[model samples]
Target: MNNDIPKAVALRYDRELEDAPRVIAQGKGDIAKRIIELAIENGIPIHENPGLVDILMDLEYYSEIPEELYQIVAKVLILVYEIDKKYTSNFNNFLEQKGGANT
Candidate 1:
């Protein structure tokens, strides 16, 4: 497959507020590039799972993901949460080092 053109799908979920994950974004080619770029700029974790993307692309945007996909989606969300936790820890460490004298 030619990687010159990219493909991506984004999902959003909040267990406390939502019953399941929703498709927040889905795109291919240039749109995929833009979606990836924006995610990077915002520090959101980017996971490349072509198989998962292929399956998710079939679902409609803003609609809750179906029951069958819950397990797979939960694993992906776990990875995202881990990434966020690591990033936050690293950032806090940096701040502590930078504020050594005052802190």
Candidate 2:
């Protein structure tokens, strides 16, 4: 793959729903752009790991990530969790500044 074009892989994980994270989507170039755009539009966190993406790209869509990647993926998940926590904090602060949530 050309390094000039961006690559992306989207993983979906739900502890009660699946044993491991699945590759919900993967693409390069235009498809990759759309994958990223959708993630941004839906407020999903994005992490960059080109080597990991390369390995994941070899896996079939909707397949669980391999055992070998568990540690690496776990780190990514931790980062995503932190990102979510920060975003939630900022959003709550924004709401409080505006006189708290309506509900």
Q: Please give the RMSD to the true structure for each candidate, in Å.
A: 1.8, 2.4
* Candidate 1: regions farther than 4 A off: 1-4, 101-103
TM-score of 2: 0.92
Q: What is the per-residue lDDT of model 1 for residues 36-94, given as tens digits with 9 covering 90 to 100?
A: 99999998898889989888888888889999999988998899899899999999998
2-103 per-residue lDDT for model 2 (tens digits): 798999999998999998999999999999999999999999999989999889999999999999888999999999999999999999899898885465
The CA lDDT at 54 in model 1 is 82
What's each prediction's TM-score? 0.89, 0.92
Clash pairs for candidate 1? none
Candidate 2 off by > 4 Å? 100-103
Candidates in order have lDDT scores of 0.90, 0.93
TM-score of decoy 1: 0.89
